[model samples]
Target: MTPGRLLVTGAAGFIGFHLCRRLLAEGWTVRGIDNLNDYYDPALKRARLSQLEGHPAFTFQHLDIAQRDDLHRLFTGSRFDVVVNLAAQAGVRYSLEHPHSYADSNLLGFVNLLEGCRHQGVDHLLFASSSSVYGANSRLPYSEHDPVDHPVSLYAATKRAGELMAHSYAHLYDIPVTGLRFFTVYGPWGRPDMAYFSFTRKILAGESIPVFNHGQMQRDFTYIDDIVEAVVRLVDHPPQRQVDWPADPATSAAPFRIYNIGNHQPVALLDFIATLEECLGRKAQLELLPMQAGDVLATYAEVNDLAALVDFAPRTPLARGLAEFVRWYRQYYGTA
Candidate 1:
């Protein structure tokens, strides 16, 4: 599809910021919105927005998607060819205390987005789901075909609920929709709440980094650029209505589909830390902790379906990605 006006929620977020920058560089007229909540740091969010404010094709707004009237107004006012929902109350541990925030952004906000798409005649709607949806599934390389019914965390539950909501909208209204289950995405401008980011901070400060599950964990740490590449490639290729639905949960008779977006390789936690140490040239103080509630042991993505559909290939090495992130961290924080 030709470049056109696009709406990207959570434009100040980790993935959202990178995506908006890439879209603007490619000549897409983009409208980026975010609640800019103090989930982490509003300063970081503002900094991300600053990077995009210079682009002529990009516009920023401080609207919360959960607010029905404001979201409806934005949808009706703008002619967006593609709509990507990245706004959500993200963080597994954080959700335990703030369940209402999860409900507001991930559930009610998603419904509002679906309604907006339904009424506004959106050609394609894409939303960010998470590998956390694989909650209790011990299966290696989590596939979109796998049933994601058991979510350990409220955050994961909300993400899965958003997927169900999108499917419902697609079935009832024939809206072309795609759901992306992104695995442990990390890189420059990443979420501070994430393990890798926090670990970096602590390692530099000579503080102990918490290693949950007694360092017996694995993660499919995907690079931000890899995630951006997958989204851009899949943007125009909306799923068509499947008359004969495949024998998979990912595809349906409606104009909807789901795919796993990840590196397709799970790294052991200890080995990941070693790589981080190598990048920072400093050893981390490890604090082994028991398995935390609502935490998964590992996350591996089965990206064959994504590859078949959009030829998605995530090829960033752990070392290289971490090196780049470390470089940015030092520069951004004025640390040696």
Candidate 2:
């Protein structure tokens, strides 16, 4: 079940980089695509790319998924066995400022990927969805069976849209598709916009860290390694025809499936900060702020289906994962 050539979009991104490295380690030829956009810091993305620069099995292309022609060219050229679409205009608040960016990348770009997979005869197509799609739902632990019709933010809406779009493609074209609902993914080489990374930077600089939602938020913070592990396992196992898919409106008939990949343990925001402080050996100056627009109060993922299907689950504790992240941060930035 080895992939001859794997195409990973957003290779320079946090998750994409890890997935590509893992694939290469497993003796697979990996082709990566990314625009190197200045979403946060292109330098960080470059640093991530530098880790895979010398790998003979890895090839990278600097192209945005929004560019349909360029993406079509790559698809036509590579004819990948597996396609993992991680490239997206990612941010809840940023979506409010630049809504068009989300439309271009998350919507148009995603359709282009589906088209490429459909035409190229890709075996398995995996794409990143978000826990944010569970918006405004007070459900204790969000499940694949739960209704995601009420998305609070534009970003969440787009992610939900991507899931539906993937389902449509899977049904019409018979492409095997899996949509992953990631819940508060964080670890080493993480996004700077994430609170854990920013808190470490501010704390080191003796600055105040903003605690959103007046520090009442909780999240199922999953580690990066665990995420990559789940993805790699799922790569070998594509969705099959659900012969007994319920007609109760909760299940679908397509060769498409969605799973929640998370730690399944929601940690309070204040407790997570405490873990960070312990990891970095510094106390953070906290400034409590009201919840911003397009923000959720909490996110808890129910990953039972993932565990049952893949026989593996994300188990990294926040304390351990943050310690690894702090170590990487200190070494990368020369802060310690």
Candidate 3:
């Protein structure tokens, strides 16, 4: 049940890089696309790309998903069996400064991906949706059954929009689509804008790190390996028409499904920071700050559906994941 040919958007990104590596290892011909924007350090993106440069099964394309011409050309040229769209303008707070970036990458870019899949006869379409879609909801464990119409940030709104867009495509074209709501994903080759990565950098530099929401936040911090494992399993198993899907608001007639992929255990921000300090053996100078706009107070996922479908679950603890990240960070950046 190997995917014949897989196209992964955002191939240079944190999660995308891991997914590409895993697919290549599983003996799949993988084509990756990325705009390689300067949202953060493009050098880190290049370093991740370097890992897959020489792989026989791997091919790289520099294209932005928002550009309809480039996207159409890529899809029409390559007959992709599975198209995983992970490329987007990815920061929550940054959406405030650059609202159009979100509209372009998350909104228009997603539409382009869907169009490509719809016209190109793509078999399975797996795209990155964020747990941030559970915004303004205080539920202990966020589930696919929960109503997520109240998104707090533009970023969350766009991701939720993506789920809807995927649904429309699935319903209209019978495209098998699976939307993954990733919860606090972190590990090696992670985004610098993420708190865990930034904290590691600042802690080692002996600089003051901002503890947002006065360090009262909690997150279901999922590790990268666990995430990639779930994604790979899903690549072979596309969504089917849920025959008994309830006539409720959440369930639809489309060949579409959404699943939460996260460590079920929610760890507090303070505890996460403590784990980072322990891993790095350095104390972080803390600067407690109010909650930033577009930031949720906490996120905890309910991945029971994912388990039932794939017999897989994210089980990496914060300590182990952060330790691995710290090790990579130190080695990558020459931080002692």
Top of the candidates by lDDT: 1
lDDT of 2 at 270: 97
lDDT of 1: 0.94
Candidate 1 backbone collisions, by pair: none
User: What lDDT does each candidate get?
Assistant: 0.94, 0.90, 0.90
lDDT per residue as tens, model 2, 30-147: 9999999998999999999999979999999899998899988887777788889999999999999999999999999999999999998789999999999989888889888888
Q: Please give, for residues 49-102, the per-residue lDDT of candidate 3 as tens digits.
A: 999989999999999999999999987888988899999989898998899999
Clashing pairs in 2: none
Give Cα distance to truth, residue 1, candidate 3, Å. 2.3
TM-score of 1: 0.99
**lDDT tens string, model 1, 1-336?**
999989999999999999999998888999999999999999999999999999889999999999999999998888888999999999999999999999999999999999999998888999999999999998887988889899999999999999999999999998999999999999999999999999999999999999999999999999999999999999979989888776679999999999999999999999999999999999999999999999999999999988988888998999999999999999999999
Q: Model 1 shows how many backbone clashes?
A: 0
**Which regions of candidate 3 deviate over 4 angstroms?**
248-250
**Ranking 1 against 3 by TM-score, winner:** 1
